[model samples]
Target: MSINTNQFPADGNISGLPDVTELEKLANELFSLLPNEMPKANFSPDLADHPRLEKSLNLVHDRLPSLFSKGEGFNLNNPQTSLPDPHFPVNKTPQSGFGVSPPAVRPGNELSLNRPVSPNSITTNTDYPGLDHKQPSVAGSGISPSAAHQGNAVNLEDPQTSFPDPNVGSSVGLGHVPHSVAGSGISPSVIQNGPGYAEAFPFSPDTPFEPDFNKLWSSINTFKSTPQIPEIPGTGGAQYYFLQGAGFKGNDPFGINQNPTSQLSGKTFSHIQNGAGHAPFDVNLIKKDFPILQERVNGRPLIWLDNAATTQKPKSVIDRITYFYEHENSNIHRAAHELAARATDAYESARSKVQVFLNAGSVNEIIFVRGATEAINLVAKTWGEQNLNAGDEIIVSNLEHHANIVPWQQLAAKKGLKLRVIPVDDDGQILLDEYAKLLNPKTKLVSFTQVSNALGTVTPAKQIVEMAHQAGAKVLVDGAQSVSHLRSDVRALNCDWFVFSGHKVFGPTGIGVLYGKEDLLNETQPWQGGGNMIQDVTFEHTKFHDAPNRFEAGTGNIADAVGLGAAIDYVNKIGIDVIHQYEHYLLVYATNLMKDIPGLRLIGTAPDKASVLSFVFEGYKTEEVGAALNNEGIAVRSGHHCAQPILRRFGVETTVRPSLAFYNTCSDVDILVETLYRLRGAHR
Candidate 1:
């Protein structure tokens, strides 16, 4: 259905929402795709065989012939007099609604948000706004299925229906999904691209996010012959998109292939779904590379899900570290020995790797620091201190990690500059309209996270950077959480500085990278001074080396830097796009399974999130949930997550967060869900 977006009013009150039949078809298709039964290792070809999975799914929804909205409460209806679900608590107190209207239609080519919103445009606060901040429980509805699936301006998770909106936040408003889904329904190439996704979407991002339809079934159970495509899963039932070619093929029964590392064995993934003559991603093979995934916890296979805190090292990274200590260990750029040359070469090679990874301008622009924290401090003391003056202001998003927030706060206090924040919507997404409102002549810098560690929100980095640049302000993107999960390009984002930690990206703990634009880095002074950083020294003064060298004040984490290079190599060998697609599968499978638990509240439900699931279960503390999952050999984070602001914005002090990485498998997610279901039964 081709939507004429111009038909909508200036207030963003959508009119002429035509194609009712099409909406119903899409909704029914969505329900059909949800797993009726999660198959075992040697699974059935029929998707309709599992009664247990269906029952588990029904725990949150009322069973009926065909599901729909009930009286006085819409499965899809008006919100003012809607009834609330008994199982989940609703926040009755209404506050100011946060919303964003679609981009205004301008015939001209050039459009910049620096100018005020056109009177013909819609703004989130003024146009079609959303309801309360809280996420309501899915309640039993008795309305007609046809009426319910009209896909109205009603909450999909309306405290009376278990159905979740693929696009909107907890409450309903309206927005469009990224426009990339205009091709072959489930193409990984377009879907797995870096996140610049706009706010809310009314339906599945794809007009039809279906499995490939072709003569693809010829090679059933022949994993060697079949070339598989990985997908960045669409919301709840995204995992099913990982199906090979046209239909379900008998593949890895373990939910992991015997060998996943050769995913991009030869060809490119530009034609990801057409059996592009490349080997499919094999999770089991990738698992073998990480020896620690073999360790048993409490006599059970350890399923690591706390990837937001740190990633487990692969054998290659470990061996690379060891290889450096045994053969190439020496202080860099100080002595003229063989080991020194090797050490310098390895360290610089890592720098070069980071430069290429981020698509940075040059190796000289990459500076090594203790981690993202120190990297932020380096910028705060050097660039911020030198440029920002009293009365100047810095803008940060409400989704910032404390590492991004605290340094700017300290700098603002020291320089007597005011700090402003861009607010978020019911979903954890930053309100682009609100962010635009905060920019002004006083704004000197804008810093925010590329991905929220606690929420898994993939913010609009490129758009945000472009906005800041338009306002005549520099931007810093904290990529500690994003680098590992997505393909972050520094040049494309065009931020003044981008920071990330090595450990977060499967590298050593102490080493991290700070990438600056070439001209910008040369213009700024170094924050530290030491032996190798000085060109010549005198009692009166000393001449400092250029950007990277001047910034390296003392002995750095030499060996770990080399390991970081190796880690980059390993990731490169198994394509970042492949990792993104695989992790998305894990995230969606886990989300669909967990949504069945009666009182589980998923905190961050952004349409464009990364691999993080943050939730709070009723009648149990987050700690209790974490402990329960831990007992089952599944690790998750259960605390404030160093992101108190965003959590508090959602009115929770803590949440049980399960994050993902490429090496993770569907089996791991299955174990996590089964354990959670057990906990739910115990509560009952």
Candidate 2:
């Protein structure tokens, strides 16, 4: 039933269907974009008297305005066409209507889609080929019969009687446009010159919809500025700052005056007690304070004896970080708010505590760097740059960690200065006699580690500093491995520079202390310039702040510093005297056990040693011994330990180092011994 009814329902609404007149109007609009030459007659053969096909093409034509209105163009069927195609080639064949010139290939350029199209090129075809074609018959193309039923998918293969309508375009013929547009082709004048042309749904009576980009951007900016919230644990009806009264007293002498106990008080006690009220200082109680001690590895409790590398944090340090984010989260020195002030107070307070912790003369002497590596570099750049000239001497120890050695080596090479090394003996102890011999008026500086990271040989820092002073050379002590295991008084040692990392002391990572003599730090110029380090600035000339601020050029890790302070607080509560004694006991215990194990050769038998026991098995390699122990839930480090020259000097390849802390127990040593014996038997 082919019914040919012309004239649109002039009500300006086609919520359901489109009439013949509206379709014709859309066809005219599409045809206007093209030239007078290529009509539907040129492309499609049969189109004259097919009433069903005409109606279908008309519906498609009416929907043209609704299609281009979306902000970004989208393909009805192909997802790739969603983005605007500026380089889309326009058909420039002689018969096409538009006067777009034929595209030319330039000699030096390639023509891949990846290459940006030259703006100088002439032709661009945004539309595809055979765009003006329309179909005359719906039945021949296996399409449904009737005017409305034929809808949009009509075939141009049939070549009988047809009215050539170029305005219908390929959109109506092949159903490339949306079905709504193809099914309801509206008027061309309405599409071209109407307000509805710029909206999503053309004829809908509903209000306009638009995305608020500003609102979205504001939300993103808000999220960017906010700091991450910390997690606080709930202790039923207890506050964040809980004070322990006499009723809730612990075994320790500090009992009610503990950090966790007395934080709520106006002034917390730093001095620990040695009263008879507490039980004998038990290692078991100390182990309980570290939560990781309870954690199982392999089939047994974890024996974490890698404290020289890094220590496990107690609850106090973790809780302090939690407190910072929850209550005092803000940028320092800039914000006028209370939270910012509190945060600044906390950060500076931590710095003061670090100053006392290292026995530095003043807080200004304690410059917070990323770690020991950057600390050494700071000296190398400022002091080395200014002091060292051609043929000036700088002495380093063979036991120096790569962090301590590389910076001096770089400075020596840069300034054409002579670099001298105070070599270690077969026992991995420094030859002090040789070091004394190296000291001359030409020696401008001497840098060495207080405790060797690989061998655990504790160097006499006071003696080294005094010897270097005799030659008028400043001394820098790399205290990476020493700080956690021993009492470090920078004033007592009298070194010009002392460096240690926070994480090694059971504090937070990425935070470290660089303790310099006050006068020396003041004399050294600012190395890196920016942010926190500046005083008053102009475009031409900027005046810098003194020492600490001059060195700290970027925003520090605030939360980590708070954690470090808390870690120091925790250590103070436990008593450093007890820590040293306990660690020494464990070292001696482990050393005796290592001696009992057959073919297990211990390296670095220096009389004055930190808690590190470096050993290698005869049958098994150092790596094999380390891995075997690791399988038994014992974690230890192997290989060069970043002191290759010192290891080579001992006439050995490498050694497995198991460094202990105060938290490590005698049982941990037993497990290590058992594992070593089993490994030897298996390998033999």
Candidate 3:
């Protein structure tokens, strides 16, 4: 069944689709122009070119009279804009609507997300390695309860269904008008003749009624900053402020706090530590941070269950990347100009972020590569080529990704070296006894993934590293899967090298990280030599920069590295511990539902695992189940997931995988299970 999410739910609120984060942000800015009592002006239709926004705004503009009737304290003078019924408590999360209006501002409240946060203060230290750089510091702020403000918000049943509804004509102030309005679909003569249409607009087909306010902005007094509600986490163009404590200082007239950091303050947006000290962050609000969550597929709202393959980017991250190109776009270490300096600082700042994020010993230890794949290949080509001689053995777990296996295999094949395997028991966990047997004197490197992407298994990485150290072998922990879900402590793991991709953890593609021990990196020679990597070039010989710069070769993915830094900033604000906890809940919720389904066999049943669910249906092919789910708008990866060995070990060629994230809700899982149950009933 194709889910029509726009319908009102029978229960408390329509919940579980993670769309409209960006929409709320755009609406927030647009709402900043309206008065608390009256929408002095309709937003010029040209505010954004987004078709969904265009249709939604157009519909809302036409339905203003209906809003006045439905809302409390309703009238043109005191136009209280809220999406849900006005009687609902302010603290309750509004049953997951994507309306544009900020919650209603009760008379004399503090500014919400309008406070200006300094760039340097964007801090939050989470359990995720290196992200927890500092705690959110607030000098003067006050906390308030959550509010249900859907003012200016349009509740479209299917936002994708209408760019400009065929039944509706273009309103005034929109830059472009339909060439043939009468022929477009609906004629103005028919509209004027329609029961209430004449009274609604009171204008002929040619002369459109103009709005009250001409410009996009309204009176400065129009904005009533309500401190009770949390700011929408991160927005591309929108600024967010969370003020809390008690008495309104009234220090700044515009409600803009001078001393604010992007570091989450007050209730910490929607996700906060409750009185019981539990991270009960609302997933609905978190979903708003990511704009892409609103994407629709096959005319249905997208349920992004393919998180293991790649996570979605938040507005903060996207904005940061845009800010870089728009302002500080230049190659680093090449010029003495302003842009060059800005670019250098941004590029190096990203490295420091990686250092703080990974808790690497020093900034020099972090090297930017294309991704974890290249990072591994860098290790094989550099240290493997330099240190290892013929007959040296390499140990890899059966739970390894192809990236970990192929590099060593190629190295071993070229050098005539021996390759050893560490077997895994059922449930896809690495066996310590088998691993111990393989770790002999000749075992030069023990490489493995901390978390299996294919099965969602979290290996005992610290133990693996310790054992490898005992055998006098160098250990490399593949953190591609683990970094996003678990706390990473490279020093604590005591591994010689740690590699992960930025894209896997909410950063952009084409950029990854290689954290090498300072000494180990300095000792290794660069395989790819270029301008920046070279200290100086002579006719006879050339010297190279040490460690990171040596391996980085030429101009690296500097912009994306800066983007990775922004991603770290975003994750830091949310706090990884909070994210991990919520994801664990989502995982458990999804797992229980899957287990109850008849004829479903779950792969990778390890007790210590991340948020990946791999299962095969008895009567259904993996691809078939995946297709059925897609028809209803859920996304799941169905294949070997690039870990053929692990799947073959589990007695299956492939499986259906739906991975969870913090943005996912119980409602999403409910819909998923409902579809699967329907499928099973039909099969029976």
Candidate 4:
């Protein structure tokens, strides 16, 4: 039959059999690539017999006879013609045997990328490794089908798995995916790293904040692989730089960093009448409050310089302890009466104040102990027992006090672990390069003092913490000397633990604080066992409470704790920052003044030091120097100073140490230097 011009879709007028013949020829060429047989064999190699092809061919044939009779020519192969079944997959007319089309995949339900899927299979949400949820949905507009496929196939909780972004969601896992596509998500903008998002579990949307033991362990392992790097001393004469604009009014311009003066509860500076409350502390008023400072020794006024051992408490600290005992004495946890309630409140309040003083994140992190010695023992027994093993080593400096050195030795002996010593230089400062060489996978802990009590050398604690972290070791700072000398912020230092003595800060004796990171503390077992520390106790077994309380076994020293809190309050009122600056000036001044004295040889000449002067006269024995100073009422310590290794390194049995507090005047230094000069003259 001949086809005429009028029978066509709107775009064109299909006129004749020539157009149909041309279309049929192209279709035949394409079909020939398939197998000879239909559906059962290969009418369409890519798909089975599609339903639309058969139906569309039937409709076209049925209309052909009528259309031809009307002379609206039957052009079956017109490309522009609207066939009855647009869904058909076949390209040729009904003349061909095949006519059906497979159903097109639904738009929203497309099998993305190269992923093959069964038509009857149910769709499920996809998984991505270490990728956050709330990502832009793969089905969302503009997300490619290929990205959806890869996101769909991603495996969660698999250490071997890696996802780039997963935000675009359509990635096929046949090969390594691009970092861009892998990281894509639905609401991808929401998946960012910062303080706000850091609070949530970094990778998981389903179980945010659930501890990822695998990642945690991986981080730990990574830390172990890297050796500790010794911190390079920055290009500055001083370890710390004080900004000039940080309220540099000419207060204490002659400031030698001295110990802070005692602050009376009700007193203010007399000179600044309008700014009466602005005075930090009163030196003259505080002198009367310290009873031992006034006591006579060898017919001369007592000049107490035994700060390294412990300081003489001011009347304020004593009065606070007495008031607590006389007025509100009771057991903290067990009491139900009014006195008990008041006592508990006071004790807990003291703990809160201690938390603030140390700048610790929480009160639960601060454990009340007998002193710094006990605190170190607690960490050794509790954390060391659980975490350290036979191959593990703990690094302690050669300049350690016996309290810091002995407990770790005991722990290492008990556990069959190795003990490593970080050697110090001739000037009593730790040799950082040597310390770095000692850190390795087996180095499980670092316990060091911030200041050398014997030599008055200040150690670089911040640098130590950073190096220990790199070596996969936890660091504990013994701040017995520093806590009272400087303003400390634990977060700024980023150490795992910090310990200090209450007595060193003019607080009551038998009290100290141990600050541990919450996670580390939670993991450690309590070293002691008693009533308040247990959650549930039985003859068979017991589960201890979490953190500081768990470490504290029996009833704690309540009155001393309160007194310590009061002592911290006193330091705050005096401003430790101001005190620190004054002490630095004093330390430099004293160092320079004492260096010029005849026949005097100073020990422990570290560039960085606190306000401690240790020296000996060439013509006199250590005892003779001590006696000479004592005769003039100048109190000082002359011995190994509980640091035998350091003194032995210098080939000295003892050194006369005059440790200064804030109350000591420049005249006092003159008296000691002048008296020494006189003593040398007498000997000559």
lDDT per residue for candidate 4 within 437-518, as digits (tens), equals 9999888899998988888888988998899989999999999988878777888889898999999998889999999988
What is residue 152's positional error in candidate 4, in angstroms?
A: 74
Q: Across residues 563-635, which tens digit of lDDT does each residue of candidate 1 receive? A: 7887887776566776776676566556665666688988987767789999999989999999988888899
Give the Å error, residue 183, model 3. 42
User: What's the TM-score of each model vs. the native?
Assistant: 0.63, 0.60, 0.65, 0.60
Winning model by lDDT: 3
What is the C-alpha lDDT profile of model 3 across 53-72, one tens digit per residue? 45545755563433323221
> Model 1 — TM-score against the truth?
0.63
What C-alpha lDDT, on a 0 to 100 scale, does residue 218 get in candidate 1?
11
> Taking the tens digit of each residue's C-alpha lDDT, what string does model 2 give over 1-684?
011112223332223433334444544444443334325342243433444344433543454333334212222122212222111222212112211112311111111222221212232322322233333333212222333133332221111111222212222133222111221222222322333332222222231211222211111111011121111234221121121111223322223323322321211111112232221233544565678888888887788977777899876677667757866787777788667776787787788878888988898998887788888998999988987899999999988888888888888888899889998877677899999999998999999999998888888789999999989999999998988878889999989999999998889889998889887878888899989888889999888888888888878888788677778876765556556655654565567557668898888877667888888789878888788888888989888887888888877778888999877766677678778877878877
TM-score of 2: 0.60
How far off is model 4, as Cα RMSD?
31.9
Worst 10 residues of 1 by lDDT: 95-104
C-alpha positional error of residue 207 in candidate 4 after TM-score superposition, expressed in Å: 83
Residue 309, model 1: lDDT of: 94
lDDT of every predicted structure (CA atoms) = 0.64, 0.61, 0.65, 0.61
Report residue 193 deviation for candidate 1 (angstroms): 33
Give the runs in model 2 whose Cα sits over 4 Å from its true position. Answer: 1-280
Kindly provide the TM-score of model 3 when superposed on the true structure, using C-alpha atoms: 0.65
> Cα deviation of 29 in candidate 1 (Å)?
48
